[model samples]
Target: MDVKETAAYLNVSVSWLYKNAVQSGLVIYRFGTGVNSKIRFNFSEVEAWVKQQRVMGG
Candidate 1:
């Protein structure tokens, strides 16, 4: 997903993803070069990470 899609999927602000997605190990994929690069996310990986972040058993 793209930044906006990802932000919506994760229910977070786009800026938060820009600031923290990499650090949180979300497996960011960058397209193109420089600061204008477009970023995408792995849906399954993101789901896994979200599961991993759980503090209690479901």
Candidate 2:
């Protein structure tokens, strides 16, 4: 998934994703170099992360 898709999946803003990229469970991968580089996230990883965040309640 790309930045936009990830943001939508998380129900957050693109800017928020970039801001929390380091702390967020989502991992960002970069391809190429310089301005041509692109970022992407593993869909499965993101889903797993989401599952890990689930809370059990009574």
Candidate 3:
């Protein structure tokens, strides 16, 4: 999904997704070139990551 869609899905700010999710090595597909590059995410991968981040019972 696009930045807006991703942010809404994650319930986070767009900048947070860029800084944390994208910058921290999460996979992002880039379209176009140079300054026009666009980023997209795989929802399944994102959902898996979210599941991985979940804390188990204490």
After superposition on all C-alphas, the RMSD of every candidate to the true structure, in Å, is 1.8, 1.4, 1.5
TM-score of 3: 0.83
Which has the greatest TM-score?
Answer: 1
* lDDT for model 1: 0.90
Residue-level lDDT of model 3, residues 1-58, one tens digit each, is 8988988988999999888886655678889999989999988888887777779998
**Residue ranges of candidate 3 with Cα displaced over 4 Å:** 23-25
lDDT of 1 by residue, 11-35 (tens): 9999999999989889999999998
The parts of candidate 2 lying over 4 Å away from their true place are none
Model 1 scores a TM of: 0.87
Question: What C-alpha lDDT do the candidate models reach, one value each?
Answer: 0.90, 0.88, 0.84
Model 2 is weakest, by summed lDDT over 10 consecutive residues, at 18-27
Scored by lDDT, the top model is: 1
Model 1: lDDT of residue 41: 91
Q: How far in Å is the alpha carbon of 43 misplaced in model 3?
A: 0.9
Residue pairs of candidate 3 with colliding backbone atoms: none
